[model samples]
Target: MQKELNLCWNFGCFYSWSKTLGCNLTMQVQRLESGDFDLRNRQLQFSTFQIINVVRRESIEIGYWTAKQGIFRNLNQDVSAHTYLHPMPDLNPVVWPGQTHIVPKGWQIPTNGKKLQVGVRTSGYPEFMKVERDPVTNAITATGYALDVFEEAIKKLPYAVPYEYVSFDTLGVNYGSYNDFVYQVPLGVYDAAIGDITIRHNRTSYADFTLPYTESGIAMIVPVKDNTNKNTWIFLKPLTGDLWFASIAFLIYTGIVIWLLERRIRNAELTGSFFHQLGTAISFSFFADRERVDGILARLVVAVWVFVLLIITSSYTANLSSMLTVQKLQPTETDVHELLKRGEHVGNGGSSSYVRELLEQLGFERSKIRAYTNPDDFADALDKGSKNGGIAAAIHEVPYIKLFLAKHCKGYTMVGPIYKSEGFGFAFPKRSPLVDDFSRAILKITEADAIIQIEKKWIGDEHACKNDETIISPSSLNFKSFSGLFLVTGVASTSALLITLVMFLYKNKHKMGINIGHDHVQRGHGTELETERIQESTADSNILHRMIQMTTPASKR
Candidate 1:
């Protein structure tokens, strides 16, 4: 025995111990086949001792000694005081001083001993967990996203953890909810619940949840419209109704204003019925042939009005062409709030704890929501919409909804931004030591792309959903986008109109005999010239009289 022990310690050979007279000591090593120069190799261990006394415990005699540590300093020390004792100090090097994670002294967990109990869902959710019956034992075999992630996280742990997945069932009935599945951990029915268990506030009050490894949120899935322009009226789409009305009103207004300024002039082109004048003004916008405007004021109005018409017509042509060539499929409801206001039926995954409460909190009544169990329900909800007794949309966590879309990739799609959630996490009993360990390991697993690998393995083929019918939504021109440019044009036109008005009044002032009188008429101009001047003055005065008559009421006149 001594010879084998010497060889084992020196050359890492097999060794055995046999009973010998007065030789009861046994040695242990820190590691097997350690390098000769390894500092940890300086270890020789003896089984520890614990002396318990049933009666007269204080009178017990105990001697603690080690070649490296030394004997107990106070042999006369009360033995009863050593109820909770530690091994004698040794010369072996202390590892990771102060950084040692003290196992929470409650439960003694064998690092690689007992098989860990993992609870899983048995309803066969593919993205989170899916269980199958083994052909031989008929035992449920678990697999999928959550199972993969759990396995990956365990592998990333510093030590191997033996585990067996047991599906949650009662009397051979499958689990009713993920919440109940999570409760199994706190109930001691499971060491951990491994599935897509959402990290909810209420659940976290009692259960420990690891940091989410998947993105968190609820989103809406709806059927994509097959025809983009099914409900649209094509002709009226070029300009909004409000803009169309305003354009027509301005066209007539330009005609009236121009007639008032030019009607008194001898060479005026406004000598026509009011309808004719309006038609002419409106036609200028369409680039129709027309006579030249007679006066500066008339020309100024025409030029500015024509420029405005050019812009309006150009915008109309471009929009008309787009609406005709492309298609516009606007979403019926873009947000949860909009759906709530419309009282549209909305579907939810069968057993999510937050879906109903979240909708209720957002002000939707409970009856407005429909709960769906599988793909058929989802398809019915979309195929028949709310008015036909089906839901307008189905809302579920993004992961589940993504799986659903991938399978039924033909006409369905997930829409709407996600509402915030904490996501799916591993659940353990509150304050379990594994929580931090699992969370840290999760970071590493995700960083090393193992999570991505697992997800791709399960869902890589699910991306076959492609749709050529995606709506090409044409951006409607809002008034604000063009308001600044229109404002500049408007201001320029008004300034020109005002200048022309001032000049027209100033030039016609003397003809009206308002700025000058007959007493100031030149005497050198004789009878014939005086006659012509009086006749011209009378004619000009008559025009002023007609203008006043047209503007005033009979009582004021």
Candidate 2:
């Protein structure tokens, strides 16, 4: 009977354990409760009440259910009586050696012995049974079994499980001064994760970032004017000293050469004294006067030398003056405020930052600051003068102003210095995620040398000088023009040199009388023929006759 009771208790414990572990164990209990036993013309009802009572006493009591009172009582009494009559000695509760009662396989009971172990041999055993105690909190935690299983299961989850939550308050305390301070939020800060919150410029840093959002550099504010007509004097200032020195040297050299030539000519004419003049006049009177060849040659030589010197000096001075004039016209200033303070009306583009900085920071009156949409219109306004018909100063980027000045306006000049000194970049909305990505893309392009190549393709570096204050030389503009002039000059000089060389060679050949070519000479006639015949007869005579004729001296004859 005790053994039978133990079996019923084990069944009940397994049923309860399986239910807790998310397994179905109720069917087996129901079968046992409903099974009919036929014996000796007497019917006995097997009630589940006796089994449940035994389970509750030996194991942890989960809960109880009250059935129809008489049914369970009558069933329990019948089972007790039957067990007593059979008195099965082997039915005594078979407890493990150290345990007071048998526990279901694969389960662990606490050391207090208040509960029964169930499902001891099942796969859920060690996992569900393990427990750990926290030293800090003295809290008992289920460290093994289902807890471990849960951890492993979590690892296999498709998404990250948020194991921890961070709070910004833990990082630092908020100070009162930050309440009213103007915050400059980086456009990137709005998209970045700050403890899982996105913030704008004015938003609190609670789970929000304080990253710097602005790209900062130096900003110069200058007046907007027609900077195209750069003053020629400003450009020439640096080269004035050199030009002056060259001009002085040329004048002095030219004066000296002219004086020397004049003196030489005078002295040569004076060299022929009255006696020589009288002799020349008497000879001219007696016979057609021979041309004064020597005097004429000397005069021609002096005249050619003086003419060459004067031509060289005049050409040098003209070229030097042109160069100096060009050097004097470079753009020097683009500042608007300074121009306005000096009583000059300044013009600016309506949308340019130059206008804003001038009025706001520079304290210029709005009426004094004239804004224009079209640059040409602005230039016209400046040319016609302000509303009062007075000359207005225009300011703009050196390059743009220079181009305008070169093409359209000539009266206006760029004044003061350039205000801003940085390259322009495309502006975008702040806190955009695209900022970092685009910046990186720009960097990549720069690294690949694409930016320089693009610049060369469009606004070439040759035009970069337009942004500077230097005046562009006309020669630089029309390369072919300069080249053509140079070619013409070279050809003319070459022809002149070749002609002079030929003339010199002819003169030297005549003076030296060198026989350069072979030609036959004709014999003379008349008396010349008679003389030639006599000479020939004498030559034919004997050597003693010719010697006797040569020995007959004039004194002896």
Candidate 3:
């Protein structure tokens, strides 16, 4: 460790005491007059003293090997302070004759300042960078994601840094004047340009950038799909063709099953001619009246069928309600590609170089594209449509598109896959000390979820626009949805009929003249009543014996 020697070198140099590592308490006091000092490869000059750590005390200029060269390479999944700047480990140390080389920071640092001139733009990008001026006060007010990020970063600094945001004439309220802010930073017109300045190759060549505060991407704002196409068969949407046919079949099958079982018993509800029996069967299933069903089999079948019908009807009603209430919105154009294919005019902020590149790639000619400055122009363009000098879709970044959506709730929406981007970052002169400091502060802010809070403050909540369904989707039912219901009714009706038939055949076997011989009956005059009673008693005994046999254990048998 080098200790600070209290030798006055210049009028700016002051007397200060500092200790070096690995020294006994050997007291030595020395004072000297002003002299020229050199730190060029002299190892033995300051061997006895330690230079005080000025990094924390002053706005030290930190020399940096440009991290942006391969900053994005081998990027870790984690978005944290430590991983924010991918240090160039392969960087060889550089030496300047008078400049003190800051090792470990991996670059040399010289003298710097505490004051900053922050360059600002007049883009008025709603939530990201809203630059406004008061009419009466004429005071310029700056607020947005960019401003919040800049302010939050400053708050995390160990030492206070005073900065004033100055609006640049270079970026004078143009629709897409992003390059203007970046160009001014390298010219010393501003210490840093702090707005939604994307870290691109051309900009970084002349300047340095902090870890991006916001995600960078290109997106678009398009008109919400028109839902005015009235569906004539909307009622039929609750159930598909297969389900409807299956439902009708089940109802008829249930009616027929009830009629078959009840008609044999001479039941008033079921014992009728073919047409009458059909009507009764249909009524019993639809109205599901169990009171008229005389036999246990008919009642049980009707009960299960009715339960199944209840479930089916309930589901249909609920689905139908959802289908009707939710507005199925389809976009006027799916994306820029779709627009290009159809040769439809797209609206965009003409000043954007990024957008121009993207539009040209999508095959949209400059003449086919319309430039819109404000909400009124965009609204008019969208209303007119592509056929009548109108725009099929609007193009902008996600942040700007989000602001537009918030302002116009139902009229417009964002669509298409977000193009890959580097995200938004603060711009600084090449190798400025603020880069590392800003990265650190940003990490702290992100870790604390301050970014989210700031975004909510400016953009409001996204849930406000979620009330309407913003897509085109037809609502329809499928047989799979009602499979369980059909299964229940089918099984119950079949089981009841089988059980009833078994009981009936068993009870009437003697009367039907089966499994009985005339030699087993004693012939007698005026014994018909007695014979009938005997037959019934025998039938009851047989039923009891069969039931007992069924319930008896196999082991015991």
Candidate 4:
């Protein structure tokens, strides 16, 4: 069969082939002889090459060789022998021809010397990670505690590994959340992600996380209410129940001692009805300078008791005054279980959807949960409260809540249970060796107190919650606080009673006859004379006589 040959025309060219194969043709074409070159009589020449049964398209090269050039001429020996190409037919149908993307293991420093593309969250959590863009130049600046830690960690590496931050918003119009941002690492969109991105179990399926650098837990924040107006028994709050009982008991004891001492001295004012005597005794204890004491022991007891009373009263007054004047800020709500049971609406901020899931897990109805994107939204929602179309409380991670409280520290406070979490961490592709390095670096920085300095730099000491709800509420005075005073008063009262008894017995020894085993004659006469003398003295003293007469009513007289 004479199949037509594929021919080409050239200004001056020729070819010679020694052998040819059918269907798959392999030919050796040689260059023209030296004498074949004619410059003046230039004419077009043509050459032919043929292959039978051309079933598939492929690349084949047809080139002329000269004696001066010595190089590999075998067609099958070199793949580059054929520069011009053809499409090869599919020989294996089982294999997929589409290319699958290869994710690089970013644990190693890139050999290409390109900066690692680190993705950062753009909105919310400004204390941990903030992304700012210049209005005119569109330049991005990533800062805050998270960024500071990340840069410091990079410096700890043995080899220099450069990185740049690319900002994205989880609450953007695209409705992306923090989980989506973390997935970017495995998708080869980012080499790493840093921010207040919490390390969670579900996210580990797509990416890996380094050890947590900050405190881990979700907390609730609510507006603080000034309870100074709401507390009705504020006066009673200054002293505990035990303290009150102890004080009253001491007051009564001191008064009884004073009245008994005055009665022993025949101070007729102490002589009255049972009820009248009780009233007289109480007045002597509390009402200062109400009555005068004659006995030295009574005076000493009263002086010590009075000192105790002065200290107790002063402390109570000072504490009560403080409670009444200072702003007693307290969280509007403190229990998460109560919030769940009441079905009160709660709000959450930032791009973390896990918070909603967590609320649901904690027995909160999904409909009762509201999501907020920014701090302002969170504040506004909390201020409105559940009854008024706002959330009753705002739930968020501790770091974010702290930042919020720092800014809104005046009327807001953190409360409720802190749900445990992994805290904030940097993310990378799965099994990234860089995870260990960064985790170790984090441990070092934390141990060295570098993280604290970084935290202070970004969050600042001034931004901390100054008016903590727990600290703002004044504690009541307990019995332990006044135990020393109670001891001193009790000792004085006991000693004065013993001394007074001793003095009375000594004064009456003459009437009783102190001689052992000897009975004195005229004991009755002696007692009678002593009694008469006492009556004569009582009647002679104008102060004693008037006191007795005034105490005695007209009907009694």
Candidate 5:
């Protein structure tokens, strides 16, 4: 053994034999590895004496040396009392020169090796943290997605974090809000908190949050109503407003083109009274058997227009039939704007004022906002409606909403914009070393589908009502859906009009005294005007006269 001891002679030093050596030197000392023992700054507790000896072994075991419950003397011979107990295994380096001998940083050193005091939120948000007490033994059990995740993360940690859940909700104790519950961590009320606590900027100011484990959004939940009985305008409901207007306008345009192409032909059905002629012009397609078209251009326009009409009518019939047969379920309230404009009351899940503040910021009156503590309250408020002293809708975090929907899957649904948020995370004291370790553990579990298993255990039926077709309403057919059809029909009508005009002008070229040669491009406008006048005098001249007038020079008109 190397007996050369590096002792501070100025402060004085004393040596005593080990306990087995029968020296009676009752000192609180544990075997320490070979290292520089800085006794100058260390708060020494020397109730007994310890021999400084270095024995060479096959391998060197290096670790921290902590003193607990002992007495020491300085250069002035003044005795100062301190207790340095290494309650936990040290894996990192840190020097504590104060009253308490703490373990190294990044690791926990509980006094007397006590378990960690992890505060699980009580009574408020059960979707993340749920606590139940047994009546026989009064034992508290914490369970939920958050608790599962926390336990899984703890298992992944390098060191075992011995912890017991302490619920904030107790007899005669006002649990307060989530913010207040989180604040208790800094006050040493809890070593950490695990729940559906959102990672917001304000909360992070006093506490550190782990990475979010759930979707980050606040959504609105509203009841759905069936519209199968309300079918006064069901025919119009098959097509959107723009589509209806476009269909009517194109039908009229096609009718006018057909009339123009056949009017100058002097067909018996075309020559009639003002209203009779108008009926023939527009309703000729319906009277296909009775009416006859003398112009090939008019026949082409009729065929294409009939095809377009066939597709449109078939689509409208199918849509209307489906609407009549199926249940048209729609939300009682579609969005918050509608609720706010109607002066309807809205509810928020839980007792926290965070969602209330958000609603107020969105311009909802203070009196119009109500807070529901649980899913039952939410259901009751929604059932009552604002007019009957109930809320029109309730807003809550997506996870809670999902759980609520799972229970009340029949008549309710989540709707409107999802207000973005930082989702749910575990909270710890600001800059707590355990935060990093827990964060890394969380990453491990999330990466290996462990989180998914835990979520299925807690919120597996989140999308249980997704396949209920009664809650979804089919969308109406819009103009864009048939824009190509309109384009085809419009092009066909215009082409036919052009072709018929060419035919009429060619058939009467000699009577109009117009040449078809390239040199005829310089023909005077008087010639076209006289030709139109002679045609009008002979025939009714509805479309042919207008065609000549449009082709004539602007100055001549």
Candidate 6:
């Protein structure tokens, strides 16, 4: 039986046994153990052999062991000689005869049959191994195999497998379980799951994760001021006191001057004692002086005063009208408590945090809150108010409010402090794979002081108002503030005009050549000269009468 079993063994069993025993078991067993077993068993057999005469019969069946030995011998010689042959008929009845099996000609399989053998020698079976090459590019195409096959292939290799063998679907399942799968999955079915196991979404039970490149916040949107209300009183309030004082002072001074001039002209006696007159007397005489001064000063004062008063009244009236109109026309509730109480119809910009604070977290009615595309629209609606039938209030950043007031010249005033302050940041989907990388880059930027540098590039520090604040020295202020300086300048100008008039009078005095105090003439160098001239004139009259008598002969002698 042992001999028969040994002879029945094929090349596979022979090779396996030889390898396991570390020697050729077939030769050793057949030579030593086979001979000893036969010799030891021959003496114990006692049986009679009977021969019966009968017709000679051809044997239909060959010994199973003998046929198996023939097949094994043929398979062994075929393998050793590298010759292709059909499978043994006796060994496997199902195998088809004369069927040719093809295998890689030049390659050899590993002795250990490891998939990734570095160096080995054996027949390379095509069913277990394959090599593919691109016909056009002549490049090795991807090798397709199972994970175990790949592991085995690299088992005897000098280095471990360089690539990770992960099933994206498996990973995806694990990740989905971990994160609760909040992420919108990309299109396509995965053979294996893939993802970082650490990420998870607690609230939604989703596996949404951020890429290393993702950031935490939205991009900073710069606040812009609409110029619709640019010239409004809200913007002018900073200088309101100065403008009001200047306007009122001008009107008062002009009115007073008109009153004083009228008073001076109307009362002739009062003009001489202008400084001594009673205030009441001066005031009463101003209008009464009209008749005495031919009504010129009175009419002029009345007209001037009327014009100035109109100007002052008109300016004040316009301001009051604007305030009242704005207050009445505003669609939103004007009072803060009213607005808070009527909290419906809140509007904010899309990216504003005020919306988050007021409408979302504060439990305000979100349906009533509308988000504006631009802050300008929000401000416009707010300024329009409930008169136009709009939202109650617009909550926005203080800086934006200031900017709007500055640019639009609108009269809308900021009524409250900053609701909250938040640092601006960039935002992305949490499932983005780039989150870590982006975070690292952000860290690096902070470490390198690049964030500060970038901030400086976009926005500088708050500017100082050098000209807005009074920087004048005390001496300069004193000079500018001196009331006497204006009075002196006026007096000096008046005195110069008076002096010019006096000089002009002196120059023109010769044209009339009159001295009021002098009579016709004194006609004297001395008393003697006067007596002589008188005697001479008397003698000349006597001589003139004789000459006239002598010459009168022609007509009237």
Each candidate's lDDT (Cα)? Answer: 0.64, 0.37, 0.67, 0.71, 0.71, 0.36
| lDDT rank order | 4, 5, 3, 1, 2, 6
Clash count of each predicted structure: 0, 33, 11, 0, 8, 61
Instruction: Please write out the lDDT profile of model 1 over residues 283-332, one tens digit for every residue.
Output: 54344333545556666666667777778778878876776666544445
* Whole-structure CA lDDT of model 1: 0.64
Predicted model with the maximum TM-score: 5
Candidate 1 clashes between residue pairs 3 or more apart in a chain or in different chains: none
Return the TM-score for each candidate structure.
0.63, 0.28, 0.59, 0.63, 0.68, 0.23
Candidate 6 on 1-557: residue-level lDDT in tens?
13222211222232223344222122212222333332344563222111111111211121121212222323224433332233444432211111212211211222232332111001011111223445696543222111222233234333222333222223334323312222323221211112112222232242223221111221111212222233455533322554455544544443344444445445553444445543433343224344433334344444444454454456556654454334221212334345446664556654443334455665666676666655467666665553465555666544334334444433344444434433221122435433343345444554555444432332222231111221211111122232343344334334444554575578679545654324234433466687899999999999999998887766665
Candidate 5 residues 480-500, lDDT tens each?
999999999899999988887
Cα RMSDs, all models: 16.5, 27.4, 19.1, 22.2, 17.9, 28.0
Query: Between prediction 3 and prediction 5, which has the larger TM-score?
Result: 5
TM-score of decoy 3: 0.59
Error of 2 at 496 (Å): 28
- Candidate 2 residues 1-557, lDDT tens each? 11132222332232243333332222112233345553555845433433233322253222221232312223324442233222233233423213445443432222233221111111111222233445796544443222322333224333222221111122243321121111212222111221101123334432233222112222222223333424566433333454445434433433333233333335332236655543432332123212332233323433343444354446555544555554434333345445557655556655345334545566666666676644566656665765465235655444334334443434345553445422222122344443344345444554655544543432345444433434454321222323343344334434444554576678888866544332212223456788989998877787768788889998986
Give per-residue lDDT, candidate 2, residue 250.
36
Error of 1 at 426 (Å): 1.3
List candidate 5 stretches off by more than 4 Å. Answer: 1-115, 125-127, 132-140, 158-160, 169-173, 289-291, 363-367, 443-448, 465-471, 511-557
Instruction: Give the TM-score (vs. native) of candidate 6.
Output: 0.23
lDDT computed for candidate 4: 0.71
